[model samples]
Target: MAARSRRMTLPSLAGRIDPIYKPATKPTSDPAHSAAFIFLHGLGDDAEGLENIADQFQKNDKVSYMHWVIPNAMEDRDAMTTAWYRPSPLTAFAPSRPELEEEEDEQGLVKSAAYVESLIDACVRKGIPPNRIVLGGFSQGCALSLFTDLTSKKYSGRLAGIVGLCGYLPLAGGSQLQHLRAIAELPPTHGDVPIFLARGKGDSLIPKRIWNITLKGLEAFDASSVEQHEYEGGHTINGPMLRDVCNWLEKVVPKLED
Candidate 1:
């Protein structure tokens, strides 16, 4: 893997940005590209956190290949660390979607979604179609991935898949989100898009009840084309979880040229 530039200026947000880029482990037949994966890190974690994930993929010979791009989260002043959004009040954290909705920082989520769009656009500019790109993240990054995938108007059906790890969907069961879904201009399979969600039943930061609620909410939206998994551990990824993701990628995405 090589670093292309310190920061590539995005058309959407005209400011300094520092994102890490890792090329595919092997070369593809297409001189331009084959596929791409955009992964995001959890709060307080930077692009470096995904380096291990990229390494894991390198060991797998069964899946279609792609270049990996992981972007750093914007800094949050109140948290004194990098975060996709401001942290909700500690007490506001609950199992019910209604309570979760009340405590969420919608504004921050919107901004994070925009940033994600910029990254996706960057991938498109590289001659890769949106449908050939996979969007994924861990924890808070997972929340942002779902928010952007569901809310974005332009990139519908363009994405190959979405992978959420150790996180629950944001704004689940919210009236505003329901309104958006009703009026959303999504592709026919948007509701049926392949979504791989995995959470630890023992996760403390995000309760198991919330994960169940998220699962039901996705189902309520007619997102039947989902692969959900649960582990008996805590808020971290394990070998079994990684294998599941690898297998899903192999099944959902087309293989690169031989």
Candidate 2:
């Protein structure tokens, strides 16, 4: 067995927030073993919070070869918690509420998208190709992941898949929405990047109506390439969802060695 290389960097942001990303994991013994999963934590969570989920996959023989990269969101609050961005004013800083008024510039959306792009670039520098990378996040992190997947101009080349847990797609009628629509029109450069969306059936944060809207938007954008699953729970993740995620990864990621 060989030692793996891990690197970390903090990138500057426009506002007070600065994004910190973990370096890619390079398998020391097997340089050729290359696949990566980037996990983004939701509001009130830090990069270290997702370690349990990553550890779950590490126990899986089928996914042992994969490298996990969990990035901390830039907008840290209370000197302890982090969030993709400040909650929209319309929602009154509560994700459980809906934004009655639309944003003028989609500032939060754009900022978060840029932060994700920075993380991707860091991965590229550390030797992970886009095709072998799986972008995923939970809750608010899911929102950022979806926004990046839809708006990124550089998202075309290579991608393994995208997984969103208890998340919804970005709302329509903005620059972000337009970019997503345009990306949908173009031929998929990654050959139907598999999408897995799982939400708790009783999630009050992302109500049933919002989930329906998310599905509808995906459908409208020709995102028929999605897989949706619902669990009987609330805002938190459960064992079944984790198991399903692993199953999906087995189908999407390349095979691992014994």
Candidate 3:
């Protein structure tokens, strides 16, 4: 109701990727943007998949001042479609046994993490600090978003919050993840940042065992700021779910003037 949506292309560290950027309708402090949310899409999807979300929020005057940056994932060479990382069966990504877990796409994860950081840097350059920025995604995007936020040395524990929709955590356990935590220097209070995680009741894309592991993994970090939800439908975003996310956003990123 207050701003117009436009197409944008931001250069990514992983490769030359075109991202859809939606500027906030009004600034929290006149002329200087207040808060931003850098949201990524799921595997086999691009920026368009999540662009409406920005529109959904901007229509509500409460969050019109929040900027939204949605980036596109490069087309997977093997899958022949857009993806944030190497194309792998989501079911296999997080298995029950650590020894039997699928080998993660470390290269893709690292590069994408760098790309996410670049997006954060872009927002920071625009005057928005890390504490005012929230990163989130759906499905594969959720996995990458959480993973990136968790491992990126520059942003771990510095973000305002994270929004993860219908996705499982990857590389959740083992000495490797611990090694990564050490490298990132995440503190015991890393859980201080709020999180919004949701799952579908009838969804088959994410198995029960893997989802449990995801919860367990988040607990390992003492992520007590989590608020999880479950919808009646399947692995798709619904109106109720969006409403819940919007409400969560209201709690995490309140009006600066308030």
Candidate 4:
């Protein structure tokens, strides 16, 4: 793919944290020929961390009109790093569903989900309809994106699609059974929105077993809505995985050629 040489203006914000934007490659050609893609970075990472990935999307002719938004996670004061929520410690022993049921584990997710909702609303105010916005993230960001969309009544049908990379749907059971129930009750259109989930089979931080449960739950909800991909890697985004995301985006978002 060629380098992205077009300059993109920073998106306007409304009483919320700002995000780094990969502007539509040809914004001046036609204002209406555009869509917004908002992706969140993984834990310990910031908005700039996904610039290279966003660059790759800018190179695709089919998605050149995408304005990719990468938001920074809230600063983890104790750890002196960024995190949307407290992720299980990186170890060979991934936490079991029961082990992940602590209420403390979900507080940050709730707080972060509010911010994610605000950001999407901000995009809508920018003239992009709710159905034209795509939400996604890597690792912890992926979990946050999924949590916000699945659990919030207001956010359910507001998204065009969801892209989750190397992450699991947290709190799928135990005390948070209400969340699972809410997701089950989502309208038919909610089930129709495309959702792409990719993971590294060898990922150490998140065991394949956990993701398997997530996949099954999603399938049970709407078999046709979820697409799964596994790569030969561990706990990270790779070339093939990104390519899949691009292809999925192309098919999911309508093309508006100049």
| Maximum-lDDT candidate | 3
Better of 3 and 4 by lDDT: 3
Q: Over the stretch 1-258, how does candidate 3's per-residue lDDT look in tens digits? A: 111234223454345456777887776553233788899898887787888878877877647778888887877786678877775555634456757646777678777888889888878877788888899999988888888777888998889899989887777756556667687776644558898999898778876666788899889878889898999988888989989988888788776763
Best by TM-score: 3
**Candidate 3 has what TM-score?**
0.88
- Tens digit of lDDT per residue, candidate 1, span 123-148? 78776778778899999988888878
| lDDT, residue 91, candidate 2 | 29
List TM-score per model, in order. Answer: 0.85, 0.78, 0.88, 0.82
Candidate 2 has an lDDT of: 0.68
lDDT of 4: 0.73
lDDT of 4 by residue, 77-123 (tens): 75577888876544344456744543446777887887787777666
Question: Which whole-number lDDT from 0 to 100 does residue 101 have in model 1?
Answer: 44
Candidate 4 ranges beyond 4 A from true positions: 1-17, 28-33, 60-62, 89-104, 175-190
Q: Any idea how many clashes model 2 has?
A: 4
Q: Clashing residue pairs, candidate 2?
A: 7-23, 130-158, 131-158, 131-159
| Residue 189 in model 4: lDDT | 31
lDDT of 1: 0.74
Q: What is each predicted model's overall lDDT from 0 to 1? A: 0.74, 0.68, 0.78, 0.73
